[model samples]
Target chain A: MTVVGYRRPAPGINPDNNSSAYASTRARAPRHPAIRIEHTLSEITGPHFETGGASAIDLTRGARGEALGERIIVTGRVLDDDGRAIAGALIETWQANAAGRYAHESDQHDAPLDPNFAGAGRIISDSDGAYRLVTIKPGAYPWRNHPNAWRPQHIHFSVFGTGFAARLITQMYFPGDPLLAIDPIFQSVADPDARARLVAALQMDVTVAEYALGYRFDIVLRGRDATPPQE
Target chain B: MKTKLTSSQTVGPFFAPLLRGDLSQMVSAETRGERVVIEGRVLDGNGDPVPDAMIEIWQANAEGRYDHPEDMQEKRLDPAFHGFGRVGTNARGEFTIHTIVPGAVPAQSAQSQAIWQAPHLNLIVFARGLLTRLVTRIYFPGEIANDSDPVLCAVPAGRRATLIAKDIERLAADKAASRRLCFDIVLQGANETVFFDV
Candidate 1:
């Protein structure tokens, strides 16, 4: 029996690993070209995440009280490159608190860490590949990448599609953010259209009345071709 | 396509809290096969340790069968084995996983030729500086079938050693006491590990 392989992303759709603007990539990115290989069972198969337990969808409320920041509702659909829904995919998100401080030991920013905000959440996309996250809007933070370098407010996303090849890790930025133009990490992708896909758009339909604002960010994973390999 | 795929991003330096579950153990006491300990560190081009890296591994069970629907090979599935593990590198850039030695499974290609793959674990590395996850594999040392393994054979001969794990005792110049294999991953530089585009 022969297995069909997932289609590779088009050129410029993915960011270059050796992007120079991101200072860390200088010493970390691979210099040699990646060895191309055909997909085997190992590549086609992935670990299935059980969706039975309660998911950590709401990050605005912790043990103490409501977090300090503007509450926002982020909703999105996980789809394949062919526009098909990728049901039951795991979506993990993490961000800094409203004061641009992470609840991590390594984060030494001169900002207060909200006792009510842990800044992490996880959920499984529904059967229709839809997922919603209720959280506080993250704030911009400063990094030592360059002098006076400030990172734009964004949420880190880790998604697992149907197969191992479909896994993705990306950051979602807000639309109309002036920092988008100057943020090297956001500008790493050479393609304008592909880079725009990383920004989430405001969606009034998902907004709660007198509650949280809403943003929509749809994710696309690599899809398999229609034709299967011959036996 | 209706929408372009989202571009990859670095996992950043703050994912340790999000990944709190114990995913380093892929087997239980009832799990079958030879138990082995895989340990390693994540390094960068300058040979400095990457303290904020996450490693995920997927492989077959003791019977050489995956816990996935795509694997239809006739083999018994271990109820106690999930055949998957995820671990974050410590502050020192070191990580360790306790798993069994997966069995070699039958390889299927477009030509339909019957071939057996050498036992290996598929690994993915996600770190603060890596825009995209790096894909690699871990092949046991002294495996006779490594020469013919389709995936291993595809890698250049000189760079294949990066994929093989070295015995911990051999590195210590002592008699082997336990089944511990060390495989360090160098993202770049002179001894960079081999990464696959698949």
Candidate 2:
């Protein structure tokens, strides 16, 4: 290993090469190179294929805080490039309940108040990469930056370990909240195709229990390219 | 378990500008202070823009001066390498550089054998939907001196097998002496380049 501190590769491929660029010289030009193919569209990545990461999730019984108001259910699926469900994926969500009140002080806001809702849930993707969570429908809240601004109730999402790109973090917005138009962050994505990825569907919602309103969402996690890419 | 995307009232304000314009501050790690351009693109398997994605470039200046205290050297830097610049890919997922190629740099350690290693650039990527930053490297074409570099040796010969600059015979009309190299880094997926763990 110490020898690597000062060695240069020559014209041909050297099995000893050990750096970011190895054998850069090829008298011939390449239009493109094809590598492996690995892709996904869900919160699914296997351990064999993973990337950068950090801390951990707070799965302990409500350590995030106590429960708050109106009960609701959130459910979703994770898919692959072929649109197949990614099994055993994990889906986690956290939000402010119907009153837009969080159990934590970081969200400091004044709105319809709910003393009992802490807003949080976790569900692992089933065989078809489908996940479900039981919580409450969160209410909209105000933002100081833009006019006519009230953020629709939404939950934050993080997907890790399905290997295509292994790590993903995004937000999920509910239907009919009416405030998607003005939020600068939500509007940052100028492409409607890209923006549509952030919007959760209203039909994915299912009425499973009398006390809970159910919702379904599907996520796509990228997979590794099976072959080397060309130029 | 619950996580908020980025608290609009908290961390949101700091990164929101990235979505609006030239996005100079949104990306870039740091620099030793020079003037130059960096070009590249963020594409999916089908050659598409990972649009609105944040592409950060960090590199050493002409004499190999890094903004990092560790790589901080008195070597005179070219005013052209300017240490940093940020460009968000357009609809096609391509980015270009008006900057100069950086000079050779010393490895990032106090190791006894450390000498000047070959020239290269480090890149970090962030987009609206992905969770973590993607770390990658960009190496110059035909820098034979890299063979024995410590950093290069750290990787396997097969994976190190990738990451080379694509061979080209033509120069841009405007570049009288500008030597150009094309390196298309692969992000793992159905039809993409090889994405490194870094």
Candidate 3:
């Protein structure tokens, strides 16, 4: 189950969880089977992606106009394990509107819904592996995971790397969110430094003057760099 | 170069809407292949259903050739077969994908130059509690080649069944219209599906 270049995910990340299961994750499953076979040229090679995508990257406005809430810009560069930019990577994001309520039937949280914000966006990384999006800062909403528990403001990200092996789905959190401390999902990663990678940093350069605040998040895919041994 | 790889966080509970919007189906009118329906559920260690999980599949077309430029094989390419599909689990924790039965591809290993791989589908799994996505492959049942598949053979013999999809009779009267296979994903415990690290 040893993945050649995959960094062992820090403890607490659940690639699978359910409503009836224990509130906190149980023991980690045994090593994965995919790691047992050496990757063929097919596994290492990826599908080609183009710059133009169908979905819009601006989530600040929905079908109508500008959504309500503090405006912010999220930008990032996708890189390989060797630090080289991955051009044309497809990035998809979904989150709650400014009120921390998702525009979905399943979300029953009491927060007010934003009619102007659907909270979904997609962008293709440019030649430099850079992609950007503008949206309202999502609010913290309560969840049934724990009593009186509120999920920290965050956006869901799906990064399609150069190859299927490089694909990653994760979340980006705002810095200084107090919910990070008590959230079992965030605290699942045992390493402080690793958890920090999940938080995007405020980037003044990417900020629009007199407009939206900007945050920078860089994502790195697996590459020649060997994965660190499991703790 | 000294910078470490970023850690993975959970995809969480809210991605079903967006995923369903864009990549739900792998087949279209022009797609070429033997049409089939692959269905299954995502279960936790306790055997409880995982309702919010999302699954994606990538595979070769009916001709065993990929839709990518990297696949230099001269096999015919199905312009309609995008070779990818995504679906979210329902209240019953089940998800279904309609795709073709992919043809076998030549082995890449120098030692196995003469051997062709078993027909299979590459998969990625993501759910609320999973910090990162899981990778696995689905092989068709009764394929004698499964015994020799480089990837399938890598798995322990007793546990290999976890990776093979079970052939089922389609309930519909027009059986030839579509084939069916059931493959459940056990996230943990004794019957956990064989996830790959690659």
- Clashing residue pairs in all predictions, respectively, total 0, 78, 10
Return the top candidate by TM-score: 1
> How close to the true structure is residue A179 of candidate 3, measured as C-alpha lDDT?
85
Q: List model 3 lDDT by residue over B1-198, tens digit each.
A: 545566666777778655645565678888887887888999887788888888888888999887765566777888787687788888999999988889987665656345678999888888776766777889999998998998888788888899999988766776666788899999888888988766
TM-score of chain A of 1: 0.96
* Candidate 2 Cα errors over 4 Å, as ranges: A1-68, A111-115, A227-231, B1-198
TM-score of each: 0.96, 0.42, 0.88
Indicate which candidate wins on lDDT: 1
Better of 2 and 3 by TM-score: 3
Q: Pick the candidate with the highest DockQ.
A: 1
Q: How does model 3 score on DockQ?
A: 0.41
Q: How are the candidates ranked when ordered by DockQ, highest leading?
A: 1, 3, 2
Candidate achieving higher DockQ, 1 or 2: 1
